[model samples]
Target chain A: MADTIDARIWRGGADGRFETFSVPRRASQTVLDVVTYIQRKLDPTLSYRFACRVGMCGSCAMTVNGKPRWTCRTHVARLEDGPLTVEPLRNLPRIKDLAADMAPFFDKWAKAGGRFVPSTDAEADFAIVEPASAERRAADAGIECIGCAVCYSACDLVSWNPDYLGPAALNRAWTLVNDVRDAGNADRLDAVAGDAGCHACHSQQSCREHCPKSLNPTASIAGLKRATLRAAWKGGP
Target chain B: MKLRARAETLLWGAQRASAAVLAVCVLAHLATILYAVRGGLTAAEILSRTRGSFALAFFYGLFVLAVAVHAPVGLRAILRETFGWRGVPLDLGTAAFAGFLVWFGWRAVAGLFA
Candidate 1:
């Protein structure tokens, strides 16, 4: 019996080759399983990053057959065709073979003021905000991002404009936009506006489509655009 | 930094502002046409009233201005994204195209009114 599983892994930095791996076939195997088998059993030196074996952690995202996906969630049997090409997530700096540097991706979040800068600190009591309220509801809807960089990897605008605050960051901004207690509204808008910010988003919705959480980062981006436009017009914080 | 982003930002602002102007112009033009056609006016008669009036000139001028500002910016972005053309060459080419739109659009409106 010939042990045969044709998998093409991106091998090297920016300038890399799609080195094929003959991963052994297995039942109920996943894309991560294939990558793991290649890294562990076949080639001990294959550089790839994965935290949790499950889909909760978004660390295992890779361009599987030209689409950004959480490899842990992607079953190998479903995509066990002839050629399986894996590349680092798109629209970001590639650090190694399959691992992309996520610093810039998270940096934009900080720049967009993704943090909930409360009016009061830990010494102060919890300010009561009804979950049923419109603002809280909006915030709650978009609060589940795992920072997997899937949306960041899937965006074309981020690819075109390197300085663009990718969808996840802007989406994070939108959540804070609705946070009534968050005091950095004006500052956030200032950070998110201009050529390299939320205004740069073309509303292509690749982020929404590729998001593992089924969250609409595009809608959140639209929300930010509308909020920023209104805030700008009104000169509001 | 790349000029494409700055150009795009300016274009987005232009698109929004021109869209506002276009909205009012479209409504006014439509209403004016409806009013004019109610009496079954001839083209020559329509020209006689519309011609040489500063208001008509202004309205048409604003209309042309909106088109001039709007079309080429959108076209440039669409072209760049679709064709993968970037950098200073594409930027200059797009800026020139926008200028051409403004010039030709004003000329057409000028002929219609002037």
Candidate 2:
């Protein structure tokens, strides 16, 4: 292992450029550690975002060596032996060095009706959901999204169609769709049905490929496609 | 929003249905071509076998219809995603393209099966 790792980090907004910093390599060091070293020792102005310093929080996701990944989870030893190129997540407006504007990403979530709508009031008894039920299983498949925007950055459809609800949002909607206690199925189906919704996805599987949690948003989107088709066929919703 | 969603969903369904038809038609068409050429038949010989055959006409006509339906929906998406084209103009444009495919595809099929 080299004593110093060459890390090229993005340094500006939309019209940004990469700035190289020779970060001291450490055993089992993560990509986030390199960024922190650059910020603390080399350049104090170097900006980035991270929380929990673990994979659970998706806020540390960045384009590392041309791939969107959770930097906190990515060990430097796992990367190919070369100068590391880190950039802001794609398909979102760059706020500064490594942070992207998450507003548009989250806004699409609302557009896709990602929020859970309760079917019963709090006064009702606890709803017993079967863990082995098909709906529960389906919901479980995509409920782990942390909104890190890695899948959103990885999606080509989101880049092509700005109005796209994106993989993360649609995945959230799919989980909610499978929720037996949620009353937003019809509206959520409508939200994720159109050209900018599930129909927009070409099933490229980029989101599935880039997801740190290994969740399959493509399958979730396919589920939405089926649900929407059934709704359309029944002439309802 | 409801109307647009329904229309888009129907269009997606149409594309998938037509693609399934195209898949079968394409396989049949390829198999027929290989079978026709296996005995070293000329273009004229193949035409003679196809001409005046109602089954051939119907099959080829179905193939052409599927193409007419399938290509335009895909092209509409490409135009929208690649070139940022949309709205009524894009719809009308793809519709026109579909018409062109139907006309030209049927013309070719007619030449083969007439």
lDDT of 1: 0.81
lDDT per residue, candidate 2, A18-90, as tens digits?
A: 9999988899999999999999999999889999997887889999999999999999999988999999999
RMSD of each candidate? Answer: 5.1, 1.7
- Tens digits of per-residue lDDT for model 1, A1-237: 235678899988899888998888788878899999898887888888999888887799999999999999888778746677899988777888899988999999998888888878889888889989998998887899989999998998877777778888988999998988888887887777755677767778889898989999988877777676666655565
DockQ of 2: 0.65
Q: Where does model 2 exceed 4 Å of error?
A: B42-44, B111-114
> Over the stretch B1-114, how does candidate 1's per-residue lDDT look in tens digits?
123333344557678789899999999999998988986998788778866788877888888888777776676667665666666787678778878877887787677676
- The 0-to-1 C-alpha lDDT of every candidate, in the order given, reads 0.81, 0.93
lDDT of candidate 2 over B17-63, digit per residue (tens): 99999999999989988877886978888888889999998998999
Chain A TM-score for candidate 2 is 0.98
Report the CA-based lDDT of candidate 2 relative to the real structure: 0.93
Each model's interface RMSD (Å)? 6.4, 1.7
TM-score of 2: 0.95
Reference-based lDDT, residue B84, model 1 = 64
lDDT of 2 at A200: 89
